[model samples]
Target: MILHIGQQKSGTTYLQEVLGHVAGPLAETAGILYPASIREVLPDAVESHERATSGLLGTEYPWISAERAADERAKWPRLMARVRAWPGTALLSAEALSTIRSPAVARVAAEFAGAEVAVVVTTRSLDRSLPSLWQQHVRNGRVSTVGEFFDLLARQRDRGPAAIEREHGLHLWRAFALGGLVRRWAAQVGPERVRVVVNPGSPPDLLWRRFATAIGARHCADLPSDDVRTHRAHRGLTHVEAELVLALNRAIGEAGWSRYEGRAIREEILQHGLLPRTDRGPRVAVPMPARKRVAAWAEEDLADLRATGVRVVGNLDELQCSAEPQDVDQPPVAPEEVAQAAAAAIMAVASRDRYAPALRRRGWRARLGSRA
Candidate 1:
């Protein structure tokens, strides 16, 4: 089985969507089973398994509620049952799986005991990834400014690994410490079976081809190439849009809105409503002061990975940041920009509702005519 454990922001979503679109063809032609259901089941299984084992070990994981833990634990056995039943090489992809502790990793490996298990980690340079990661946190309701986020990362880097694991949490640190992540999986799956694919900046097809080769499913060439482009890249919000969302999150909390309502506001109002209209602003860049520190860390990580001798698909140098620093760091979104986003969001919702009653009436008439 091929298990793609992601260091997020490394094209995992795009790869998953493309794989999902061609899952049937890939199964038929290449004997690769990337069932659409695996997309849903894999993350649940990983999370549930992690939570269950963590509970047994008396470890506390952030955001894991008791009810959620129990629910996930209950769902895991059924998910593994599906995996055990798969007839050919199974492909499972989930970014969350990257953070699974040693015990959970062992458990997952044990479940696929008889099969050939290869672990694929898709990685990007720390300098490039930090900004993207922060943007992701913002999307999920983090309110920290870019400067504050980098400051936290710089402090964590200075304190070293133990502090990083303790303070920053597994997801954040695993992304920064790529070699350590590889070693954790390598200990169980064997270094030979761990493949790290460096994300080159261009010729987008390169990552998928390398992944296909790693999984021993070269016949995946039969799948349509256009499927990759059809899925939109998971773009991060512009500075103005993100600030607006952050402010909105604060308002939701102060208003004592229910979880459902808060989610609707974030997803429906900000993501769906405002995001589409916002221009793709400047790509997030590592703060100028921290660029050197991030590059140094990236160097250390690359050296460590080299020492471990895990199979690396791309040039190690690709992991280094070569881009020149920005002349001046972009400032926070102006109040004017925030106001504009707010106005756009309101108009978007209003426009949608304007047609809603007429659409409902049309649907009702259609249903009545059918009955008559």
Candidate 2:
């Protein structure tokens, strides 16, 4: 069975839809079976098997620091069992599972899948990724300012991968990015067995061709690059609008929220959704010095990171995106200070009171509640 683990938001959706929809024709030639409930049925097995051993359940979904889960997963042996059971290649695509959760998950997953499984993955630049990621979080009601957003970035790095995974649990990198995560898989599965695809906006059939080549399913006939239907992503939010929305998120506070209620915010973004990529709005610029500090940190990490066979798509120069430095030796921006300023600005638009209840309502507290 060949497993295609998605590193999320990395064209995995497009891949899933494309692969699934064409599975019939692909299977007819490739001789693989993608049963109707493939995505549903196996993930449970992965989860249940992992849960059975780890004894930890949902402190957070996609929890990577799940030592127990990892341990349990190592012991569960379902990937192996499934591999042993299946005849043709089995493709298990869980974007969340793409990261380096545990070396064991890769080892056992590939071991059981037989010597054949090649992990197919896609990646993008972090800068290009930030805007999309912010929009995604906001859709899910995670409203963090540019400064706080960077704060979390700094913290995540200091804490290490597992910690970050348990905390934020987004960033396809948490599951699979070209860093150690993919390296671990490649190391175990063999570099040849782990095929990394450059997204480069290839047409679906082209992508399918690449995938077919990787999975040894080249025989799966395909030439209809034109007939394939591609779903253009919904319109994106303007930079200002995105900032405004996330800022409003700070006002919601931890009092409470409804899952469905946020639909309006998303709908508004889509309805009015046009990403004026050039729409520059309120920016959170860190002092130049702080940027240097972050740059230093990243360089340190990069040193270690480079030692391993991992690929970093963006430059260290770009990695300090969160640090909008004023000077070459400044401290990172403080979120509370930023919150106070932002809240005050928001209050200016509210009724006469300097302390806008709405502003406080939407602050960090609200972010916490959303997380809760």
Candidate 3:
């Protein structure tokens, strides 16, 4: 079994999308099955077994109800059953698995006790990942300003990984503290069995090709990396759009909306109302000091990572932190920009509703014609 335990925001969604689509063909050609059951639980989405992995860990993610967690918990066994049934190499990919602690890691290791388990971790440069990480938190209902977010990260850095993991369940370093993460898994699964694939930041599918090589599915390495069709559910948020969403999150909380209700409304606004619009503002950038700090942290982590002698699929030099500081150091988002973004989001939601009935009617007629 190959487990692609991910470092989130590192082209993971793209890779998972490809894996889900090519499961059948890949199985036929290379005897590698990205099991159909992973998608069967959420057939409408190619989320790559996140729920199953979450169930395995019993992670109490924010806003997840007890009923939902139990339902997902039940899926773990069913997923395992399908994996046991498959004769060929089976693959499961989930970014959430990377956040697990040492004990959880051991539990996971024991689950595939008799099976040949190989772990693959996809990573990106720390310099480049900070903005994306912050945006993700904002989307998840954080109202922290970029400066405040970096300040919190600095404090977390001072406290170290254990404290960070204990206090903040989904902190960036839980996954991106590369050296610690590698060491923990290596202890469980053996250093030789774990392969780290570094993001090279180009051509998009390079990550997938390296991933394919790591798992011994070389035939599928050269498959059209661009042709896989999947929803861009976690698209990167731009500066203005992120600020707008952050404001909305704050407003929702202040209005006394329940976390679950806020999440539903927030996601709807993000998917249909905000994300659908073109990203028209400046991209998020780290200030000079924070950039330097993260770059140094990456250096230390990479040094520790090298000492472990874990197998690496791509150039370690690619993971080096060399991002140049941007002109603005966490610039204040303009109120006008926020307003413009809010207006666009409102229009987007309104237009979607306006056309939804017509689109449904067209689909109905098409179905009738097919029946005829």
Candidate 4:
């Protein structure tokens, strides 16, 4: 079994999309089973843990509930049953799996005892990952400025590894400290079975080739690498756009939107509305002052991974960020740009709400006319 445990923002979304695209063809050719809905097979507890902390918004986010627990319990057996039915290697993925405790890892290992299980972890340099990670937090309702976020990280770093794990929560820390994450999973699965793929910042298809190698799915070479979805893939929000989102999140929270309602705003309004606008602004990046620190942390992480004896799939140097820091800090995004993004997002949500009823009425009218 091939398990892709995402360290997040490491082209994981793209990889999952590719895997979904090739599920049938790969199964036919290589006896590989990348199910269309891989998460259905993971235990409910694991799912809950993922949902609770994946956003890096802290554990008080209120996503956990009895209803979700029941649903997850139901899913675990269904996943196992599906795995049992599949005749060949089964592929399961979720970035949140990186945060699972050793006991949960043991449970997953036990569930697939008869199968040859290998864990694949995708990682990138801290320089790349920090900005992406912060942008994700923005998407998920973080209101902290980039400077503030880094400050939190710096303070957490000073408190030691356990403190970092405790304060930032397991999901965020694991993502940042890639080697520590590998160690956690390797303890259960063994270091040799863990495949660490370093993300070189070019030729988008490099990650796929390395990932396919890790999973024994060389047949994926024949599958189309281009993202073929009609909708634009999610991109990092521009600095101004992210600031606007933080304001919206605060408004939504103050208005006391329910979890479902908040998600609708985040996904429908922010994700579909603001994220697709390529003309929005420059992609967010780590400020010059923070780059050196990020690079040092990355070097330490690489050293840890080297010590573990896990299979490294790409050039270790590609994981290093030795670039000279820019002289200026990230420029303050203009208020005008933030206003424009906010206006566009508001309009998108308004348009959807305005047209929805008309579309429903038209559907009803057609159905009634057909009866006549």
Using alpha carbons, what is the TM-score of model 1?
A: 0.81
In the range 254-333, model 4's lDDT, one tens digit per residue, is: 99887578767778876667866767887677776677777778788889889999998899888887657554236778
Report the C-alpha lDDT of model 2 over 1-372, residue by residue, as the tens digit.
Answer: 556665555566666655656666766677665543334556422221224223222223444455545554543354445545666766656555554355445444644543555666665334334445556666566777555665666665667666644444544445523455556576766655666554544343555565666666776636234454344333344344555566556555453556455555445443443233243334333334335545455455445445655433323343333445233232443555445434444444445455456667669657867999
Number of the candidate with higher TM-score, 2 or 3? 3
Find the 10 residues in a row with the least total lDDT in model 4: 52-61
When 3 and 4 are scored with lDDT, the better candidate is 3
Clashing pairs in 3: none
Q: Over the stretch 4-103, how does candidate 3's per-residue lDDT look in tens digits? A: 8888888888888878777778888988878665556577566588788767666444434667777788778878998989898888888877777777
CA lDDT of each prediction against the hidden true structure: 0.71, 0.50, 0.79, 0.71
Those runs of model 1 whose alpha carbons end farther than 4 Å from true positions after fitting are 38-61, 162-170, 201-203, 225-227, 322-324, 327-336, 351-372
TM-score of each predicted structure versus truth: 0.81, 0.58, 0.85, 0.81
The worst-scoring run of ten residues by lDDT in candidate 2 lies at: 44-53
Per-residue lDDT of model 1, residues 191-225, tens digit only: 99999988775666676777677777766744656
lDDT of 2: 0.50
Model 3 clashes, total count: 0
Can you list the residue pairs that collide in candidate 4?
none
Models, CA RMSD each:
7.2, 11.7, 7.7, 7.9
